[model samples]
Structures are given as C-alpha cells and as structure tokens.
Target chain A: MTRLRAAAALALAAPLALAACGGEDDGTVTLRYAFWDDPQRPALEAMIDAFGEDHPDIRIELEQTPWDEYWPGLDSQFAGEAAPDVFWNHVSRFPAYASSGVLLPLTDRIEESGLGTAAYPEDLYASWQFEGDQYGLPKDWDSIAMVYRIDALEAAGIDPSEIDDLEWNPVDGGTYVEFLQKLTVDANGENALSPDFDPENVVQYGAAMASSTGQTDWWNYAVQNGCELQNEPWGDYAVDAPECVEAIQFTADLYNRWGVAVPAEVTNQPNGSLASEQVTAGAAATALDGSWTLGVYRDGLEPGTWAVADNPSGPAGSGTVINGLSNAVYAGTEHPDEAWEFVEFLGSEQAQAIAADLGSVWPGVSSLNGRFADYWAGQGVDVSGFQTAAEGTTTEYPLSLDDAAFSTAALDEFNQVWLGDKDAQAAADAVVAIANE
Target chain B: MARLGTRYPSSTVNALNPVVDPARRTRRDRSTATAYALLAPSLVGFAVFLVLPIAAVFALSLFEWNLLTDPEFVGLRNYRDLAEDERALKSIGNTFYYVLLNIPIQTVLALLLALVLNSKIKGRNVFRVIYVLPWMAMPVALGVIWRWVFDPVNGGLNRFLDLFGVDGASWLNDTAWAMPVVASVNVWQYTGYTMLFFLAGLQAIPAELYEAADVDGASRTHRFFAITLPLLRPAMLFVLVTSVIGSFQVFDTIHVMTAGGPAGSTATLNYQIYLESFTQRSAGYGSMLAVVLFAVIAAITLLQVLLFRKRTVYDFS
Candidate 1:
C-alpha cells in the first residue's frame, strides 16, 4: 500500500518538475528579434545596445538571416510557436504574415507612444497599416532615382543641365528619347543621335534598366501614364491596362527600336552586374536604380564619375515610388513587453539618426531629419534629387504578399517582349492571366 | 535409486507434480516474450519515422496548409493547379535537359576512363585515387571552388580562354552555357564512381577471351566490340539507369551555383519544388511537383529496365 502511494506521488511530481523547467519567470524577460539585412547588422546592433541601456531588465536576442532564407525561416518558427519577439517585415510580405495572425497589431502601442500617423509620410505609414489595424512601425524608407555617369554625358558633348529639367507627357517624351539617344555613343565615335550610326558595333550604351527583381521602377512609369497595377490594393489584375501596355512598350523600345540601352538578352546575363558594374566600368552612361546605389557606386567607382538625379517625369507628373521596410512584434512572443520596448526604441529618433549616420538606411522618422542626406553629401553624392523624389512628390505602391509571384510571372512574360518575340499587348495579357490564376 | 526412502513418498509427489508443470510453462512463456521485446525498438523506429511520415505527407497533400493554420481539405485542387502550372512544366523540361546532358556524357566519359585505367599502366592505383578525389570532396566545397573556376569575369576558365585569345563569355550568366556547365561539373564529380563499375566489368571480361580473339586475327577494336562491349552491357545498363535517376534529381550543385536563375533557365523540377515549398510557401503545389517528378523518374527507370533486359546477359563462364 505504501509503494502504491509512493508511485502516485512520483507520477504527480514528474509533471510539476517539467512544468517548472519550462515556465518563464515574471521578473526576467527574453525577446527574439529577427532581420534579413546583413549590411544593417552593425547599425541594428547599435540600436539594440541603446535599447538595452534604456531597458536593462529586458534581454533581447538577435537573429540574423539572409534575405532569401528569411521568410521561410520565420514561417517555420511561427508555426512552431517559436517565432521571434520582433522581426523585420517588408511591405510586400506584411499582408500575408498579418492575415495569418503571426504579427501582433500595434495600434494601441502607436497611440500610446505619441507617434501619430501624420508623423510619417502618409503613404509610407499607411503601407504598415492594413485591415483596420497597424501591424508594424515604419523603419526605413527608399525611393527610385536616376544615377548617371557624369563624364559619359559630358564626353558625348551633351550638356547635363538641359536634361536636368526635362519633362515628359508620355505622349510627347520625344525630348527624353532624344536626350538618351544623344547620350549614347558607339565605338566609331558616332553618337546614336547621329544619322550615320552602326548598331552592329555599338560600344557604349546610353541607359540601363534592371528588369530583374531588385529595382523595378518601370511600374512607376506605367502608373504615371495611367496604368493601374492592381484594381486598388488587392483586388484584380490591372497591368493589362492599355496605358500600362504603352508604358511597357516604350520601355522595351528603348532597347529594341532606339538601340540606346543594352538588349535584354545581354543585360539578362546571369550573375552579370550589367547595370551598376557596367555603369561604373564606363560602359553604360545612366542607370535607373534605388538611391542606395549612391553609396554602392560612390564607394565602388572612381571619384567624380557618378551623380544622382530625379527620375524623368511621365505623362501625369514626376512621380517616384517610396519604398520602406517595417518592424513588427511577433504574436507568439514570450516577452511581449520587451519586444514592444525594442520595437519602440527602433522607431526612436536617436536610433534612427545613428542608423542614418552609419549609412544603413534612410531613417523612417522625419524628425531624424537630413542626417541621411548629410551622409550622402559627405560621400560626394548629391542626394537632393533623391530627397526631393522621396517627399510628397512620390507615390508608394501597394505591396501584397502575392507581389513576388506576380512579379516573377510578369517579368517572364515581359522577357518575350524584350526579346522582340511578342508585342507589349500580348505580353501584358499573358502576365495578367498568369497573375490572376 | 540414490534416495530410495519413499515408496509412500510417491503419493506425496503426485500432489505437487501438476503445480510444478504449470510453473515451468509460465517460465517458458516469459522467455518467448523476451524475444519480441528485443525486436520492439527497431520496429517502433521504422513505423514512426518512415511509414508514419510518408502517410502524413500523403494526407497533407490533399489540404491547403501552409504549416500555419489547420489544414483545410482542398481535394484534388492542388494537383489540378500543378497540371496547368507553367513553372512546373518549365522545371520538368529543364530536369529532362539535365538528364539528357548528364547520362550520356557521364556514362561515356566514365567508360572511357575505365578503359584507359584498365590498360597496363604504372601507378594505376594512384591514378584511380586521383580520379576519385572529386567524388570524395564535399559537394558544397566543390561547388564554391567550381564557381570560382567558372566565374565569368575573372574565372580560371576565362583566363585559360584568354591565353588562346578567345573572348570570355559569361559561363554561368548565359542561359545556353549554364546547364552545360552544371552538367560538366556533375560529370567531373561522378565519373570516377561510375568508372569503378566499368572497371569491374572490364576486369570480369576474361583474359582468355581477349587472347582467343587475338588468335582469331581480330584487331583491338574488333575484340572490344565483340568481347568487351557485350560483356560490359550489364555495367553500362546499371550506370545509365542510376545516372539518369540521379541527374533528374540534381539539386545541390545547381542550388549553390546558378540558383535556377538567368531567368529560370536552370530551374529543374527538384529545385522548383524546393522553391515552391519553402520560398513561395506553397507546399501543396510543391508536393504535386514532387509526385510528378517521382512519376517521371519511375517511368524512365522502368523504360531503361525494359530496354536493357533484352540486351544484357548475366552468364559467367
């Protein structure tokens, strides 16, 4: 009878022992923070340090993953109920994560922190809010801009000042095309603008547009010309709009008809950094890329060779796409308070200024003010155009979770048009069908 | 006889005899049970790891689960979508191209190397080890080293080409050259293993037969065709079928090297399945691709078996 009683006692004690080992302390808290940008690690670490100094009671663990592996890793972690307390989320991917309830709604935190919606640029802030709830705080912002090889333009005997204020109506952008043609010079010392030009032995290119995944502002051009990407938000495919077709055709024609840009066949070469590398190597005159390239090109290229400018205006106006990254607290966090603290610190002006100074990103807060612009100026890059492009003049596109898949399908269809195998109308139709399905 | 004190004690023994036999039966039963107890660990492991997981995957394929929410049953919708998927179709085509490029080239190269090594050469063992070094090297390490060698701008291949005044083309970036480069890398790695099979087949081709062919005024070519070729059919069949299956499932090198890029030029079905499942979070679509890939590999192996059975004879005299 005593042995039976002892066995029951052991059985009861075993579960209590396991429970004690697994449960967290109310006094101490641990938080996990995840992000994809490896280059931003130092700045993030510094911010975490500041957060730690402010909140000594809470400990935060940092998790760094590469961009390609970041999403999948988060998904698995979330499923296992081991998700990080705070994570870096992209606007394009936020909807999917939010819909799945992996992200904690931070509407209350935003209100309590005294950071109003008006504090951020409206579009940039709105991108983090969806479905009547705010899921993230704006972390960093970027915009598309034109980067040019200054020497290449001057050597072609074209004054860069004339094209600086060049405007376009999409219908009457002949001047933009003419400027591009004039800037394009070949091996025989004959410019593309000249009547006696050889297409076979073309040496230098006028412009380069990266149609691949990284920097695609061609959609902005389409939007400026009255092309709707989706039927507002996540409704239906609208890239097949007539104006969108015209815009894509004009972009493709820059390569095929005018011979100013490198053909997609050569430019699409895998692992070939045709845009930045070629521009830096003096093979291409201008490149359409993010303002982030100011740092990359300035550090990579010879001094006094490159400069940044605003994207050329389209039919509607000079519009640019302002892109930003956001930070979210995961729903299944063990230490929700600590995670919120870390996230709030990340949004703090001091952290943003430090991040801006380190050249990590354009700080999301406006109060951080011109620190990033000053950093760019220090690097010998005139970034006033990028700043102008990032202000109220810019537009921010809606990034749904399906954007990656849709973009992949769209680009594949566009490749056929770029190769001249199909026209713009057919390609757009194919892309729409594929994207809808 | 030693304790013969009990003619009356026999009556006492009869009372306890039946109880003693029952106790003996219980002990025998317990020993028999111990044998099954010893086998329980392996049986449990096999059932839990292999059979149960495979069953789970099959059940999971019918649902629309992204490993987040409870799976919602979608019936055959995932499979139906896969059938019309252009990405899956392209991947299947790319996988076939890889197999087509790898099987014939790897088999021939292996057989040729095997023949050369079979010759009466000095330090034959050393040569064999040298040839097999690539097979033994870690695949990831090999991939990184090969990427450096095949780097378009400053690669060893281009430097060598430059020595001959040939303009360096982007080996990995160009769609036309990517698969061939990947296939060549696979061939370089697997040729030695395949060569071992060929070498064994070569050694088994009796010395007496070759001598007899020579006495019959047959040249080396004639002798090889008449003797070595027919006898090595078994090895060739084994190499071809296995290499075809292996090439169809090629993932690691391509993943490390091209990443199914240059606009999805090298995206094989295996790589696509990986991407769809992990990158796109479409496990249902990924499973469908996996099932199709399995069907393709099964069909090819079955075809090879049917074709090779007619040509190969296993009689050893």
Candidate 2:
C-alpha cells in the first residue's frame, strides 16, 4: 500500500519535474529582433546599442536567417507560436501575414508614441497597411535601376551618352533594342547588329535577366509598357492582359530573337542570377535589377568600374517597381510594449543613419536621401541614376495574399516561354489562370 | 502501495494455496515495477514527439490553416482540392521519375564498390574513406558546386565535352535533362554510403560457404550468384527501402539547384509540399499531401518487405 501510494505520487510529480526546467527568467524584458541580412548585422547591432541607450531595461536578441530560408523559417516559427517579438517583413509577404492576424497592428501604438506614418516615404506608407490598419513601420525602400559597366560600353564603340536618352516601345522596343544589339559582341568580334554576327558564338551579351524573376525584370517591363498586374491590391491577376502579353513577348525576344541578353539557361543558373554575376564577369554590359544590387555591385566591382543609370523610358514612361521593408511586431510576442518601443526606435533618425552608413539599403526616411547618396559616393559608386529613375513614374509593388502561389505558377510557366519551349501568350494565359485559382 | 498490492494479490496466491510466499511475490512485483519504470522515459518521449505530431498533422489535414490564422474545419476539402490540382499530379509524377532514376544506379554501383572493397587490396581502408567523402559533404554546397560544373558556357562538364568535339546541352536548364541531373547528384552523394552497408553484408557472409562453392567446381561468377548474392539480400533490402524513402523526400538539392524549374520539370512532390506549406502558407493542403506521400511510401515499402521476406537469408547456417 505504501508502494502503491509512492507510484501514484511519482506519476503526479513527473510533470512538475519537467515544468520546473522551463527557461530562466531575468528581471529585464528580452525582445527578439529577427532580420535576414548578413552584411547589415554590424550596423543593426549599432542601432540596437543606440536603442539600448534610451531603454536600458529592454534586452534585444537579433536573429539572422538567410534570405532563401527567411520566410519558411518565420512561417514555421509562427506555426509553433514561438515567432520573435519583432521581425523584418517584406511588402509582398506582409498581406498574408497581416490578414491572418499574426502581425500586430501599429496604428494606435504609433499614435500613442507620437510618431506618425510620415516617418516612411509617402508612397510606401500604405504598403504596410491592410484593411486600414498599419501592421508594419517601413524600414527601407527599394526601386529598380539600370546597373551597368562603363568599359563594356566603351569597348563596343557605343557612346555612354546614348544610353541616357534610350527609349523603348513594345512594337520595336525602340532604341533600347538597338543599344543592346550594339553592345552585344560575337566570338568573331562582330557586333549583334553586324551582318556576320553569330548568335551561337556570342561573347558578350548586352544584358542579363533572370527569366524566373518578377520584381526586377519582366514585371517592370510589363507595367512600364502599360499593363495592370491586377484590378487592385489583392484582386484578380491580369497577367494575360494584351499589353502585359506584348511586353513579355518583347522581353523574351531579347534572348530568343535578338540574342542581346544572356539565355535563360545562363541567367537563372543556380549559383546566382546571371545579371549581377555577368556584369562582374564582363560578359554582360548592363543589368536591370533592384536598388538592392547597388551594394552587391559595390562589393564586387573595382571603385568607379560600375555606375547606375535610370531605367530607359518605355512608351508609357520611364516606370519602375518600388517596394519597402518594414519592422513588424509578432502578434504572439510576450513583450509587446518592449517590441514596439524597439520598432519605434528603428524608424528614428539615428537608426536610419546607421542604415545609410551600412551602404546596403536606402533608408525609408526620405529626408535621409542625401546621406544615402553620400554613402555611395564614399564607396565611389554614382547612385544619382537611381534617384533619376525614382523621379520617373513608379508603379506599386504588386502584393497579394497569394503572392507565393502566383509567383510559383508564373515562374514555372514563363520559364518555358523564356527557354523557347512554349508560346509567350500561352504561358501568360496559364499564369493568369493559376493566379485566379 | 502495500495495501494496493495485497488487494490485488499475486497469481502465486492460488485458491488452493492462498498466502504462500508473499515475500517472493513482492520481489517479483518489484522487478516488474522496475521494468516499467525503465521503459517510461522512452514511452513518454515517443508519445509526445512522434505519435502526437503525426496525430496533429492528420487532424490538421481536415482543416483550413494558413499557419498564422485560426484553423477552420473544412473536412476532406484539402484532399478534394489535391485530386484536381494538375501541378500536384505532375509533381508526383516527377517524384516517381526521381525515385526510378536514383535507386537502381546507386544500388548497382554500391554493389560493385562493395565487391571491390571486400577483396584484399592495397590501401583498402583509405579507398573506403575516400569513397564515402561525398556523403559527408553538405547537400546545399554540393548543389552550388554541381550547378557551376553543369554550366553550359564555362562549366567543367561542358569544357570536357568540348575536348571530344561534342556540344554540351544545357544540363539543368533543359526540361529533358533537369530531373536526371538532379537525380544523378543524389546518386553521387549516397552511393558510397550505400556501399558501406553492402561491404558490411559481404563481410558477414561465411568464408566456408565460398570455399564450398569453389570446391564444387563453381566459377567466380557462379559463386557470386550462388553464395554472395543470396546472403546479401538483407543488406540489399535495407538499402532499397532506405534509398526509396530518401529519393521520395529529396528537397534540399532540388531546391538549391533548380527550385522546381527551368520549367516544372524537377518539381517533386516533396518540393511542392514545402512550397505549399511554407511559401504559399497553406499548411492544411501541405499536410494532406504529406499524408498521401506517407501512404504511398508505406504501401510500397510493405510490398517490398513482403516480396523480400521469404527470399532474404537471415541465417548463414
């Protein structure tokens, strides 16, 4: 009977023993801040120190997941209800996370803190909002620009001045197509426009574009050529619209017909996208990539070797896709007040200065534009072209609750078209169908 | 505890001999209690980690969950949706192709390497370690290196083909070649690991049996078939079952190398499941697909086990 009572006691005591082994609790409130960039860690740490000076009671932990695994990692963390107190969020992914109520709405908190949405760029302020609720505070913004090497153009006997006024039209792609042809050189030292030029033996391509990419390449062309991605934000996809299809066809023809751009096989190789790589390799003269590429080009090239240019004007106008990154408080955070206080500090002038000092991203605060440009100047990269490009017509970065699903379908279908295995129109129709579904 | 034991007296206290050897019965009861106490930790861990998660996934499959949102009950909807999903069907087809491509080549190569390693050769231990090195390397790193090796313009494979006056096709970027290239990387990484198992099986085969075959005027080839092959069936079965499961779940290499592209040529069922669950935020649909995959693997493995049960010689004697 004593043994039986002891056994019963043991059963009851087991859970208590395990429960007693829970995490150690200190007096200070610990807030976890997660982001995906490796190069910006030091700058971010500096920002954290600056925040610590103001709120010494709050301890911050920084979690850095790589770009490819960031979203998947965050999703699993959320599923487990153990997501960080605060995390970096992209505009494209914000809608799904926000709509599902896993992101803490920040409108009332911002009002209480006396910091308005005016901290972010006027255009990007609405990007982090869903259903009239602000779910994120913008951290930084990215816009598309034409990144190029000067020596490659000079070697092809093309004046660098000509590229400044280049225009594109879906009908012939205008002088932009001609510029690509002039810059493209064959193995026999013949230009793409020369009579004896061999597409098979091409040595230098005019540009490199990842066929699977949307934001940095074809989507920009499609929108710039007068096509609406959808009826509205999170509405039905209109990828099969006539203007979009024509734009995509012209984009594909840059490789298949004109042989001025690197083939899909080369551009979308697993190592990295070919544009940034080939520009460094001197195989391609130019690349159309987001402002994010500025740091990559800066780190890769010799000082003054590469320069930025505004994306050439299409018939619609010189248009580009712009998006922003934001710091969002996880809805399940244990320390909401601390997380908000830390996030609030992230948008302040001191933190934006650190972002500028890193030279990786343009600050979300437009007032710091001169500092951002000056940082690039210190690195010997002329970034005025990006500013010029930003001055032109800008399109809203497409965001949807089903962006991943739509992107997967679009990548699969359009890749075939880019590879010359399927018709562009058919691919566009297939993407549209998948998007609607 | 003593009162409880007396209430439910041991079987030793039969009706004819009621109070016989109470001390002995208590000792037996104590040993039995100790046995259960010893097993409790593993039992508790298995219940919490394995059984509960699987049960949760099964329950989750019948609902609509976006990972972040509250789950809504939508019984059988995920399964119904998967039935009509063309991409899902295609991914399953691609996974089967991957399985077929990976298993046979690796098995044959492993057997051959095992045979060579079984012989008394110079630097045998060194060769064994050298062959297994690829398995030790990370999959993501291998994918990146292999991608460069397969590059059409400046890749080592293309450069080698150029020497033979042959034009190299786009290895990973072509729809016809992508799945095979991806599968070949798996074979490259795992064949040596499989060979170690075969080598162990070969070592276990009795030397006396081979001597008997030799004295019976059997040729080397005949002895290999008559003695070595039959005796190695257990190892062969282990390798086959494991490789099949591994092939079906291949994701990291495919993701790093192709990301289910050039087209949808290399998008296997596992990759699709990952995309749906994590990227598309459709955990419920992903769980349904996972259940289907589990069923397929279970049925196939069961069939294999049944087929090999009678054929495998577990005892050398």
Candidate 3:
C-alpha cells in the first residue's frame, strides 16, 4: 500500500519536476510574443527570424491565438499577471487595455529608443495614446471598400467607372439604389428596376449589407453622413444621434426597404456568412468588405471576374472606416526593455515593408502603402480603391473605455435591426444607452 | 449473477467477506488506508477542479472584477442586478427552451436507436459506428457545417427544399426556429452517444425475464414496459441525469450557430455567462450567473436523484 501511494505521488510530481527545470542552462533570455492574425504568421515569423540574426541570445517565442479567442484569453492572462511580453492590439480593444495599468506606457521608451514615428499617420499613432501615455505603436492599417463583380456592371450596361461616382442618402439611397436596382435580378430574369421584378425570388442580389458591426457596412454610411460613432474619441456614446440613426435606416433600407440587397435573414448573424463569403458564392454581386479579406477574394474567386471600387458617397460624401492595429508590451513583463525593442522593430519601415510584401495588410508606414498596393497589382487585382476610400474622407474606428461592453450590447441589439425584428432607431437608442452606461 | 445483486457493486466482494474478528481490525484499517490512498489523487483532482472553483466563483459573485481591474466588494449588488436584469431572465427562459427542445427528442430518439441497434441485425456494428460518428465529431466544426446547411438562401437545406419548389424557412435567423435549429444539432450529435448507454442497459437485462414473460404470454409491449423499463431504471437514471445536465449547459453549438441571435433568441445561460465574463469583461456578474447556473444544475440533479432513488432497480438479480 505504501509503495502504491509512493508510486502515485511520483506520478503526480513527475510533470511538476520536469516543468521546473525548463529552458537550457545557457545564459539566454526568452520573450513570449503573441499575435492573432494567422495569414500574417509567415511574415511575422520571417520578421522574428530577421530579429534573431541581430540578437540571437533573446529567443522571441511567437504565440498565435485565433481572432475570436484572443481578447478573452488575453483578459484572463492579464488577470493572472501572465500575459505575453508583447502582443498585437486592436482599436476597439486598445482603449480598455490602455485604460487599465496592465499596458506598458511607451512614450518615454519611444523617445529613449529614438525610433522615427513620422512614417505612420499622426492620428493613427495618436490613437494608441491613453491619458498622456502611449501604450502601443502602430502595427498595420486597413480600410473598407466596395468589392464588386466586374461582369455584373458589364451585364447591367453600366460602365465599371460609373460605380465610383454613386452617391447615397438616408432618404432615397440616391444613385446607389438606381445602380443596385439595375444589378439585382429575379428568377424570371427581371431586374429590380423592372415592373415584374419579384422580391420573393431573387436570383442575384445587388449587394450584401447584413454587417452588424457596421465597420464594413453601415459605419461607413454613418461616417459618410457626418455621424460620429463616439461623440469624441473615447468620450461619449453617440450613435443614437439623428444622423447616425438615419444612416442606419438607409443601411436597413438596402436590405429591407429597397429589396436590392441580400435578404437579412440569410445575411444576419448568428449563422451569417461574411460579406466576402456572400460575394465569393455569387449570392451577392458586391459587398463592402475590409482590406484584410483581400486574401479571401483573391483565393475564393477568379482574378478577372471581380474588382474593388471606392465606397458609394453618403450625404457627407466619400466615407470608409480606416482602422489600424498596434503592438503593445504587457506592463508586468519582466523583460520590458526587450519587449519594447520588439515593438520598436514592429513599427520600423523594414518590418512594415515585409508585411506589405505579403499583401497581408497596408503597412502603418505611409511610404510602404505603395508596396502593399504593388503586391496586389502584381496579383492582377486593382486594390487601389481601398487606398482611394481612405484617401477620401475616412472615419476612425469608434473606440472607447467600455468597448468590450458595447461590443456585447451592440451585437445583440443591432442583430435585431439587421434581421428587421426591431426598428433601427430603437436598436440604436438601446445600444447607445447601454454603451454609455 | 449474484455480483449484479448489490446496491454498491464494487463492495460486493468485501461484503461477502465479513471482517468480524477484532484481531483483523488493524488489517482492515490498513485496507481502509489503502483505499483512501487509492482515492487520494482523484479526490485532490475533484477538490481542485470542481469544489475549489465553485467556492471561488461563489465568493467572486459578491465582488466586481473586470479582469483588468482589482475586484471590489459589491455585496449582493450583482444578485440584485441579476434579479432586475431582463436579459438574464430571458436568457434563462431561452436556456430552458433549448433544454426542452434538445433533451426530450434526444432521449426518445436515443431510446429508439438503442432498441433497434440492440437487436441482431445486418452490419449492426457498422450501423452503431455510423450513428456515433456525428457524436464523435467536434461540435464547433459540426456547427460551422450545420450553419452552412441551415443558411436560408444558399444552404443545402434550402437547395433540397427548392427541388420540390418549397422554400425552407430561415432556420437559424427566425426567432421561432433558431433555438430548435441549434438544439437539433446537439440532439443529432448526442442521441447516438446516449443510445450507447441505453444499449448497455438493454444488454445487461437477464434473458430469464423475457423467457418468463414469454411463458406468461405477455405481449412484447407489455414485456418491455414491465421487464425492460423497471429493470433499466439505473441506466435510465444515469442517462436522464447526465443528459439533462449536458442539455442545460449547451454552448458550443449555439455559440457557433446562432451566437444567441437573430435577436438574442438562442442565448442560453452558459453563452450569456461567457459573453458577460469574457467578451463584456463583466467578471463579477458573469461569476454570479455561473453560480446561479451551478445551483440550477445541482437542484435539477438532486430532483432527478430523489425521483429515481426509490424506484430504480440497481440489481436485476
């Protein structure tokens, strides 16, 4: 009995004993680096490989958490005081993390390191600032643009360039509706413009617009209408403003009131496909999608069949959501200095160029934008519309302290508006109220 | 045969060997010690994974912690908030809706499958494996596939319906159908697994009971009702208790499929807890919800035990 008990104790303690003796006896330091993007993993790995050539003693371990679980996992790790030394940060999530003392303030470090920050946009760099301290540095940027079928424009007898000038309003949807009407076809071969167009049996939808986040959907429209998602940066929840509601209603009008867009039932969560998925399947001829989904289109469909276009103009004219991510150092990290060097490396022109070469996203460095654009041009796809969309008026992502709370609240409430279960105004009011609370 | 005739099956051998002599007390003590040593690892694990967490959760429910911030005591504020929270009430209602939609159908279907597969038939083993494959598949992967299948416009379900000029209802988006659609995935995945338990129970029945029924000229239905059900009570208890517990905690399928939408219609307690704790970072309220969930599960399990305690036939012999 004693032997059996001893054996069991040894069995339990064996793993702990092995765990305690981790890492080689060499005088090498290991730093854990975390990121969420899977497609960019190769580029990040190559960057780390390059980083190792200069500093081989510092072994930077890369941990890739999938997008969905990244924040939740990070939150727990933060509570346990064991988050990675450095990790990627998003605009929506950045505010919450920055407000908390868990993030290492990088203002003094940025000055001490003397890394040039002029390459990144001023606003983009400033977005990572909480109070007076810089919690992160710019990593990459993305913008929303209309991804459409070139053939659909040809079939409708409309020039592909005509889509560039399409404008919208919350009241009538403007020329954009006329364009959508021409493209939206019924099973009887009738366009939405035709007298016999059957809304019941749509063979091809003009567009896909069931995005509840609105980053790739109504947020652009809202931005175009001069409606602010937040009253001011991280100040007040203001999507319930009349202009924002109007933009939301106009967005809904496409799915419900106009009958030109894909039915919300098939497009709304929780089982809804992405805007790119709908277009890839030929369900919808076009969708306002993020530049990150460039790969989804490039991989899912043929090269010449589809093309990207600047977003349709809203009341305030040419608007899209321009968002960027940043690399942040955990405050509690033992090797904060090494983690800062990694973050500094991430923001450098060289790293940005590497990311641009992969066409993963537009690099934060303004000079490297062409490389990102050139990479796709070589792929036989004109992705300049994404750049043009941002070149015009752009709306910064609505980030706030209660972003996590707002995300949960908005998902439930806006899903109702997308499904046509609740009024757009009511949903907007409810969400704004919840967010401000 | 006699091994099956005890309340505690593992204690049968020891029960047969009585430790009556006072001189054998030390040996009994040593044996008892050995038993405790054997159970010690599992007991420690149970304490760590289950009891400690429950206690921590209960304690945390009284405080406000947002993962990033320090936990501050809020006394019964979370509970009071939960009482007034319409969303919590609705989530509970939705959870029950999911449980009701899932459990009864899954249990009955499993029972039917068990009865069919328990018999001698062609490729029975193959059929058994085929039915259990869905159960074996990961819920998240199954959910993604099922989401595609249930897509109203381009899904396989609508395509199949289109063959007969019948339009399929929006399965996951329609509030009326979302809970049922999500529950159907769980039912489909678990019914086969539950069937295996019933199959074991069915096989464990002594052949003499059926023979006795045959001599009494009892009908197959009568024999099943009297001999099969009464004798299978232990299995029924096990299946029903575990199934009910599993059903109430359904999250993965719902998480991937409906995400507690098209208007928070499919959001169950577990999903809500996750959203509050993980997504919203409402750790305190989330912990409170978890405590409520634990209590509800415990209460239901207790009720099940009480209901099944007296009538269950532990030993057919």
Candidate 2 per-residue lDDT, tens place, B3-68, comes to: 211254556557557565989889979998999899999899776556655766677778777776
Off by over 4 Å in 3: A1-28, A187-189, A210-212, A269-271, A380-384, B1-40, B313-317
Identify the candidate with maximal lDDT: 3
Distance (Å) between predicted and true CA of B224, model 1?
A: 2.9
Model 3, B221-280: lDDT tens per residue?
999898888878888989999999998898889888887787778889999999888888
Candidate 3 docks with a DockQ of: 0.47
Clashing pairs in 3: none
Tens digit per residue, CA lDDT, model 2, A335-391: 888889899889887798887877767888888878988998887777887777677
For candidate 1, give the lDDT of residue A420.
66
Please list all clashing residue pairs in model 1, or write none if there are none: A270-B173
Q: What is each candidate's DockQ, to 2 decimals?
A: 0.16, 0.35, 0.47
lDDT of 1 at A17: 38
Clashing pairs in 2: A1-B1, A1-B2, A1-B3, A2-B1, A2-B2, A3-B1, A4-B1
Each model's C-alpha lDDT?
0.74, 0.82, 0.84
> Can you give the lDDT of residue B69 in candidate 2?
63
True contacts kept of each: 0.19, 0.56, 0.63
